[model samples]
Target: MKSNINVVFFLFIWGFLLACTKAADPGSTVIIDPVVDVDYSDTSLRLQDVAPFPIGASVSFNHLSNDPKLAAILYANFNELVFNSELKHGALVKADGSFDFTTADAFVDLAKDMDIYGHVLAWHRHQGTSYLNTLVGNLEQQELLLDPGFEKSTTVGSPYWFVLNSGDPKGTATIAVTTQTDEVKSGTSALKVVNPTAYGTADWRVQVASNNFQTVPGQKYVIRYTAKSLSGSGIIMVSAQAMDGSGVTHYPGGDKTITGEWQTITLSFTPTKENYRIVFNMGKKADTYLVDDVSVYSEVAAPDYAAIYTRLDEALHTFIGTTVGRYKDRIRKWEVVNEMFTDAGEIRSNANSPAPIVDGQKEYGYFIWSEFLKRDYGYLAFRYAEEADPTAELYINDYGLEYSDKKIDSLIAYVNEIRKRGAKVDGIGTQMHIDIHLSQAKIDKMFQKLASTGLKVRVSELDIRITNSSTPMPPTEALLEKQKEQYQRVVASYMKFVPPAQRAGIAVWGVLDQYNWQYNGGSDYPNLFSTEYKKKPAYGGFLMGLSEK
Candidate 1:
């Protein structure tokens, strides 16, 4: 766009009223305004200036900041910028959960003049894999608690965590599963125990114990849980009891005092028996107690599920909040989550590297945040972004939306679901990275589905590749023409289907073919510009699409 900016010259013509002499009002000379003409012709127009919605292009911050010519082209045309990899998790976040925002800070400075959209706050790949995996420490310890939180409990009773004895004393005693919001300390439900009788006469009045679990002698085990009572005060006793004939019992963390306020309890001890059960001696108290997130594991290894959850949750918060907050006033849009689903639209699976580590993460390693935090993590991440920058338009971007029905639908469904869960997902970004041969029908359907959602729709990454099967590199003219038409169709479809109120904008994937990332250092040519930074035929076609009615 900048290369030809000079061709869009203005024509200034001075018109003299020579005919005024014939009609004549003597010294009162008739004057005419200079004729100014601006050529809106294809050869001279700029995509960013011509498009109704903002036009964006992905570029390397290094090239954008260091290479003046490339930077000039971007500044001359694009209004919004997407960094190729600098803004991603692996690029900014360290293995130790620290951030290096120096480059991103400079990008924010550039955003002062233009716009910079947040690439991602959470994703499966390009992650702080080491830090995340480290948090989910090793598999050295196995959980030994059966239905610890009473999740197996039906309305009637729990199968694994069952009532051993009740109503043995003067007072009534029973155990039930509670799903009340206030009663649940961690997960969706908690175990509710009420003992109306103080078990001073016989502690067996009400005994709710977990099914006995096998234990190894000399193995250390820890149980962590939160307990609270309806009233302001109560006393409860927890014990680890041997199921053997000896009937010996041990209080790992000793007895506990339950209160109106929830209190966390951690019981750690080494087992000296073959099998034992965790007992809630609530018969000692006459008040109702709620317990949740009761996890019992033996020993700490490199990674633990509970530990991983805590660390990753914190990391997710830090990554979203700190990064978004730093540029709260600068950026207008952010991808709170990206590519969370597979091509088949299922939640992505957990995976580790096939390659060794470099920097912080391995090339093939994946830390599926969704796998660890679950779907609710989306809401949490969105909330963090919202809190950091209330004005930013938050989005969750994904690829294959145009080609895969499952991918597209599931993404839309997930977006809607999270929105209902209080995530302010202002938009959904479809990364349309395709080949010139992509079906127009799929494009139409994809756009139609996105527009119907009424959320801001963005062509987050637009690039039409010319595969080797279709054409050879130094791409044949015919394929280039298809590329041109493909570009036009994308922008035109976006405009035609998405209402003006919902148009977030369209962003070309990259500036030049060589750096297109499709076949980096290879034959891939998937951008609007040639390697020389010269605008190609697709640029004009894209402009035409933006000019569409």
Candidate 2:
């Protein structure tokens, strides 16, 4: 009986071990504590709630527009949307003058309920170059002078001539075209210069020259003009002076004394520079001179600006009619003209070479546009933009305005000048693509100055970078914290400086760091979101800034 009982105990122990082994098997059920659901969304702040004005992001049309996560973030946080490149002139207008508004339309359709900011109506870089070239191709190959007769004038000054006086302290010299009908040599009018004060400086003379005349170096050219003195007989120095930013090089074409009767003076010389202005200098004696029918011609023809103006006007009208008019309801704010000046506060000149090609044709270089339209291009762009969308708020958008005080000053002057010319400019766009290392004082000063302009100011394309070089390393937590501080400071500066009425809004450059253009080949943590679409500290910092009074 004892042996049988011990056997049963052994069998029971073996069965219990087998049961334990089965419980520990891979397929065995295991109970765990219930996971406490933590909501990350509660810690997040809505951008629009913090911002006094509209909060916006520059969005790409592809995935950002449709992706559930991105769309959720954008829709929930932003009330305004600016397309990264969809609404640009190049994207909208095709090479054949036909518009492919597919991308732009898609963007508009997506953001139809939100406020849409049109990127640019006219920009030298992103134009439909092929269409623009086609408009001016024939004129580009030929040499022609504009308004040679000095007949057309909507204002007091002559259309194509820039009148300058040297050594006159009282500024008595004045330029006008005589409309008396009898003073003209060939046409109905003559360029009339009245200089009452005589200053004895050798360079002290009344000068009239063609503003946009192109001359080839080492190329022969003939200049002919008819002139007569009304009061005093004096020798008028005729020369072809190259008006390149470097000191003027005066190519002598000899001098001719003008009497009472109209005398035709012909001068022939080869220019030493590419851009030559045919200058007529009336010597020191104060007198009234009448000059007419000025003609300049080279063996190789130059651009005919009068005809070119017609084509350019047509092109501009077409562009405005198609893009601005089509989406007038959706897009009410436009960067009418963009990047007109460089960082040095100088008007950007495309004199050296043509801008990079877009759509298989050379973009409209700055020199070409300035030469054709003179300073009226900006005015005309604004005018047409206003005409297309009468309610649209127009802005002159430029980069480097924040750090470069001189650039901001110049841009202010430019905007004022455009407004003075009867063009409607509602705001100025300062593209604050800056580094965290930039002086906070300088940034504050910039916002102050911009606000002083009294026009609505928009901090367009706001991206703060921590890295300096294209080859970026993984940013440290400290560096990211610095970036967050900067982002907060920028938003706070904008809020404190920019008046509420004049606040056009701010647009973050992009949604993610991985997609930032500054991220050359490596990591650049510039944006408020990480590659995984999680909001970074900078996002909260931006919110904190806007939350401030």
Candidate 3:
């Protein structure tokens, strides 16, 4: 069975490459007579023997399902890694702050049940400030002496402590109750003891915490919430606190009146230190405080090449044995989640920071992306993906880890942050787009820092554009060679750090130049193959470099 397949594979690729190069490489273009038959009895050679995993390719879902042979061809030629934008965290978290685990959870379950590996989590934005307000309110309230450190006294004691009944001479003090075991029985039961005298002057003591401070040091996090006062009026205070070995520290806070109509609040913070806890308290002495959909989270980390690799593990398995099943393993090798970053191609900082990349300034990217890397979803997504697919390799795919120092620096910090939190990120992808003028030494040092975390590395997206900056496109041979050299240096540096077993692989963005995204130029024409499906000169150069001992 193996021998027959090998004969077929050799015949096909040999014929294909031969046909493709007939006009150029005359020595390799000699046409064999079709009538000359050769015996292929030995089935010893296998696909894995030639290439352990197939050279992978990236394709939109629409393409794979639309073409029957294309899927099989991908499975035969390479291992697969998929780019699924739907599994990102922003889409997963609901407006109420609790995760809308439906799609993400389904993706994970399908990976296990189907055996394809891919992303279970991504660094999409998640700001549940509305839900987080309530969370912080609860956390801050916990810090203060909200309950007086004891339950209500059933028997009468001092006037300061005795439970007062409705209209019992004392000024009316509204009290809210939250029944944990069961829903509160309303009417008079929910308001059994409202001190009538307690309300005249603000003498009663109730704890109030700031509703704002929400963060997780070195772990990306976000939270938001919206709630309505079902029946009564109450002053709600919320705040943030640091959870120390001793207890919570209340600081920086906010509050508002939760009117009967639903009120929405948003809270976004990245904790560089351990001060990422939120607390809340209700001021009404005797009002039933009803809360719903309280949400809390560390910030969501942006998807870098490293994280993309991690997510692919689950994606591969999820697609296995399904219509897209055969390409699962290949997809695990080199899948590109295009534009996973913000439109400007940078990670977002906290909510207050600008969206994605603001005006292409490195500061804007750093301000937001740094916060994201340090404490946002950087840790959580890795944790989940690691648990979901232990054997599958993963990467955080991105478009601009190459020429941008701010991006590179933040990425390093982000990688470090996740490492501190114990993530299994295996590599860093510098989506090679333009011909970067980075010093080899500087690039080497960056890899060294990333390697210190003990991860594999990759040049996830390798495109070279030499068109106008105003209207960017692919490059000419002269331009492409320079781009190729840039890629060669990067791949070379990456090879220095990665061990053979850990090396999943590297890939060109597209097979044909025409199909490549040169039109979106930052010096396009970076691909090793031309638009006509012919290997560019760089293709031979890369094959030689990659094959070097």
Candidate 4:
């Protein structure tokens, strides 16, 4: 009877174990189709073999170092390698002014080993804020004007300067130097201009004259001063004028709207005369204006509009010299300036954009660099890249130009403009990230437009999305076939439109569908290969496209 009880207990334990196994087994409930792997080596044609230009891909340095599969795919398919993020400004320069090049060194070493061409030298975005701000701070502290902070005072007024009431003599505007500690914007004193009543004449003004110093003629000078209003709202017309024997001639300055908060106004001018005076026309309003920290000096001594631009241009050159100078022997192609324009066909402006805060201090962005450099920013970038790597083919790269006519036109115009400014741009890179459904005619037109510029054209970042906006449908056989045909047409169109000489190369943006950045919501197949390093049907399509006349 005891033996019988032991057998029953054993059976009960076996039943519980079976139940647990069944619950843990996910394949038992769902059907998973086996993936058929296709070795690209076994294929009739490879991407690197059939292409006239060097076939390239933008690769992640981390993945290139860590993932053997990714490295194998890149090595087999591509002859040229472009880093997606590793070589950008922010990656190279650290906050402490030292460069971290462990990843970059590894990448270059791999490129050297694999016989892959290293492309790209400089780009605009992802720059180190702390390093750049330090440069700006150093220039700002270099004082040029005498008693710029309004700390020194004389019997006449502020040291080395005096107040003048010009224009309508009948106007009831008064001026004085104030030592009010609380009201001053900087130092222990400020220049106060009070207009008690509104003047009938528009030219009624209060001016500040330099007593001993005089501006150099035909030299760039920066005039910077702090100003605020006693009332919450008023308008102050500010101008830097040459008060010579002839008369007062206004330099390049404008009106400033004042609120309760203290604001610094900086202006740049090339003086026509040796002696100049800064004029603060406040007779139009019946309000008190408090001004402090007035300064006037050559562009080299101060950070004005032109000086900021000069410094930025120098910085760009320095960055390129440091980076490209180090790797020019290995890298022969560069995307000098990347994505300078917005999708709306406008230059990216930082006039009102939010500034980046580093260590609790706000720093300038790339837009500020662009603003200071103006249209010459691109010119300087290309020039600097060439100076660093003279043999490298520099290309200006931008996205959305392929789809939009306005954007393409703007890009062409910009290229021409830069060329006119003596920048020797070698190629134009159109980031062809398009949907499969986009018109082939539009793509052909974009290629033609780029070709007309007489510069080498590169289809820089090529990737096609196979999904609609709403959902990412599974990659059915029919959809895969359709995607294959679309890839064939694109490759064929590129070959057909671009002359063989001007075709710099076509680079696949990414290697595998699973690793594609476009696959955000669900499973979307966009690349020529699968996650398991198997060539998809799109691979065949690319080969066929190359085979065409």
Candidate 5:
């Protein structure tokens, strides 16, 4: 009878809240539900009581930063900080392999000196190999494949190509190209003839020397040709001239041979103060080659060593300065450089070198996505960060530490080497990205061994991917009970290490399964929250342990 009364009271309160009238009150209204007493309890319960710290929830910079209420809730609750950054560009080591540190230095100076932390170092994955390969291939090889029609294409800054009058090879192969200064154009729109197309003579070539064009260096250009061979192999060479404004007389030259298949060629070259021209030739007879599609940009410059450090500095500032920057603060130690030690630990893997594949491993090569961190950039990046923030800890994070005890032993040895070489080493971030079933015991033990290094241990970016389901799995009564038990077990285990402080805080990689890396969580259960952000059994279990409020 008491239970039935409680249910009736709940509905009454629900209806009152739902039926509140702004028509009469306008601003706010209150609702009330009657309390009822129940019989002596006989309910079963599981998990220890929650002891929520005085702190609130973690502040996420991306979304929650915009909400004042949520932000206040976090500030009042959790002391954790989080910050995002704008150092989108990574510092480039120069072509000569020297650090410039201009861009990076500026950003870092702002952070380290100013006591900011929102923009600590990040890997900046936007320029991954897939993106770079496309940029390089298109600019260097495919840009030159344009068809030159009778209507000449715009040459506000296109390389000058000699379009020979197909009628015959005369001293006047009309150079119908546009120049910026208009020095080449005559009264009726005829351009001056430098090295005009000749019948069959010396390997004749006409090129738009990469002269004084007001554009970024290393821009891509398309060298196109529409040619008809009358007699000789109609060869048209589009070579980027060496930039040294020597009256177009002393131009550095290389020749690109054109085929009879009406082809367009692309060249990715850096332009200098020297004159660049498009040279055309027929080797023996009179033929014509027309051209189009020329452009320039400033994206791919030689490594700006200075800029690398400047950006690093900026990232550090954003990471530590704002409320959003709190996430980085909690990360007392971070993965400075990514991957350092292979199973062998000798041949570095960053600059496109291969890693030694484990025996019977199907994947071979250094930097294999599934295996190694694949390079030393992770190390170098960490070093720069340590210099900027001398006190805060730093680390080299990687996966595949499960090869054997030998691998972890080698990493320790490797960190020692880096420290000897002036790197401020702190700890290792082992990504527990795989499903728990694959190697749960090994994963747990790996943490134990890594902690033995005397450096901090973090379950950085932890997420167990469940790929099979799009919606929440209906928890069987048994499964819900099991989930509660499992969460309690994990939490309790971590509490054991509280005495030593060797283990820092553990963070779920994302808030929910939907936001996690495995967008489609496979068969494995992931996260303490459901996809909708509603608390799940795991959440209640965790909060029960964390909150004593």
Candidate 6:
């Protein structure tokens, strides 16, 4: 009776609760999601704002025009722009040795309110090499034939000259080596060929080809030799074949008759290719041919130093003065002379240079400006920059100074020496293209020495080389941390050692690590931005170093 009563009471209570709550009609009304607050104040950070001095970036002109994101980062961060290459000699000067500043002028136009830093006035590399070479002129293409007069050997041999063929009938003709006064020409020895059978019009039938000699393209070569025929006035065909197995034949003055008396045969032809073998075909008239005094010459002008010096001196004045004068209104700072000293602490000249005026060739890669102008090259560059803009802050810049005590000392000394000579060098830039693990002690020491000079000091071309391996590798957080630390340490050291007034500024070589000039194959972590244009840890680290939170 008690259980029945309890059950009835529970049922009644459950029914009453269900009646009171009617399960909110499924999906009848929807609830809205609440708006959340987020912070992105850090993303708005600009490097130029925190840095004490101008934060510069060596920027590419094409990227500014093509990549909007890259341009945004550039405009947002950097206050000064260093043209990656537009102002370079090779870029501005055409092959004809004339200035074409269309691209350079357009590059300056992108610097809206930003200062322009004239990269260089004089440099051996990135120069108009062909034009400079033309100024000096290449020496005559001297003798190409090893043994011009067949003087190397009295008999036919392989090393110097080789007689390729005997005759058409297999043994109808004999190639005899003789030093007889009647047979030989200028040299003591000569090649005497006796052909008894006439394989008329079959020029290659009785052939004696000389050993191959290297030929230059478009080089007008003159082959001069003395020849005589025993049978009066017999046709001896001379043809040239490429020794490189190209099967290409050059028959400029091939088919000609040799008189009974020894006569000089001059054959002139500009080669279309390289590696040529001279061929003599004497089977046309069944004659005994005596050939001697073979000489191959190319009429190339000798280098005239006086003329070269004059042309280049005038060219230097024009390149520097004209470029700076045009941009004087916008650019007030200039790197007057770059890389004037070798890593060995010695001044670079022809004696220390590899591209000295070569004997029979032209150097198109490097032109040592000091080879002609001597130490006065830098002096002249400074003079030219001063002449262009009297108020411009002129700097002499170089690399490898952080590690090389001798190099730093040499640069300082040279600057002092040049200043005495009336070259107004206003600053010195140490391109701190260092690695992450580069000794802090070395960096401090370098800063100390630079600070001692009392000239404006700049860390130009700042980038950290993560790895020494040429092969590409995946980047690691540890490596990145080290790069960040390096970037921070370098900045802090500049502030610690260099006086505030003398800090010309620290210019990160590139805005992004992957955009790094050195980052071709492998991953490089050198800049403040990642390859995706995202801010890197190095960016915060650099900001921290600038005394920013």
Best by TM-score: 6
* Residue range 1-549, candidate 5, lDDT tens digits: 123334546676666656665344746556352322211121111111112111112223443534444433333223333222232222322223233445433433322212222222444331223322222232222222222232244431343333433223443444444343333212222222233345444544332333233433445443333332322245554444443555432212334444444344544455544344444343333354433333333344454434444443443333323212222443344445444445554334343334334673422212222112233444455555665556676765655564456667777777766777777776666655544234445655676677667776654544444333445454454554555444444444444433235544444444444445555443345655555554456655444333211
Off by over 4 Å in 6: 1-44, 139-302, 355-365
Per-model TM-score, in order, reads 0.62, 0.61, 0.43, 0.60, 0.47, 0.70
* Top model number, lDDT: 6
Q: Which stretches of candidate 3 lie over 4 Å from their true place?
A: 1-54, 66-77, 84-120, 125-347, 350-353, 356-376, 390-399, 404-410, 436-443, 471-475, 518-523
Measured on C-alpha atoms, candidate 6 has an lDDT of 0.80
User: Cα deviation of 542 in candidate 4 (Å)?
Assistant: 1.2
Q: How accurate is candidate 5 locally (lDDT)?
A: 0.41
TM-score of 4: 0.60
Report the C-alpha displacement of residue 403, candidate 1, in angstroms. Answer: 1.0
Better of 3 and 6 by lDDT: 6
lDDT, each prediction: 0.76, 0.74, 0.44, 0.71, 0.41, 0.80
Write the number of the candidate with greater TM-score, choosing between 1 and 5.
1
lDDT of 6 by residue, 1-549 (tens): 123223434565556546545765644553321111112125455767546578889988887888899988988888889988889888888778788999989999998878888887788888888677777676446676777777777677677666666676576778867888878887688888888888877756777767788888797888778888987788877777777777888787767889999998888877777889787778787788888888787777767777777888888998898889988998889988888888899888867767645574545557888888877788888999898899999999999999898889999998998899988988999899888879889999999999999999998889887776665655688888778788888888898899988999988898876678888855566778888898877776676566522
lDDT (10s digit) by residue, model 4, range 1-549: 123223434555556557667566645453221111223234554577546567778778877788889888887777778777778777788876677888888888877433333344444456776676665553443345566666677322655666666335643566766887777887678777777766534734555565445776887777787888988576676566666775756645566778888988888888788776666677666788887887777765545666666666777888777887888777777788877776667665565334567775455334245656767778888888878878888898888877778778887899899888888899899888876787878888988889888899998888877765647787788888878888888888888888878988888888888667786645578888877788888888876677545
Off-target runs (Cα >4 Å) in candidate 4 are: 1-44, 113-124, 134-303, 351-368, 468-470, 521-523
Residue 324 shift from truth in candidate 3, angstroms: 16
lDDT of 6 at 355: 69
Clashes of each: 7, 4, 120, 0, 99, 0
Stretches > 4 Å off in candidate 1: 1-41, 140-304, 351-365, 468-472
In candidate 6, clashing pairs total: 0
User: Per-residue error at 69 for model 5, in Å?
Assistant: 8.9
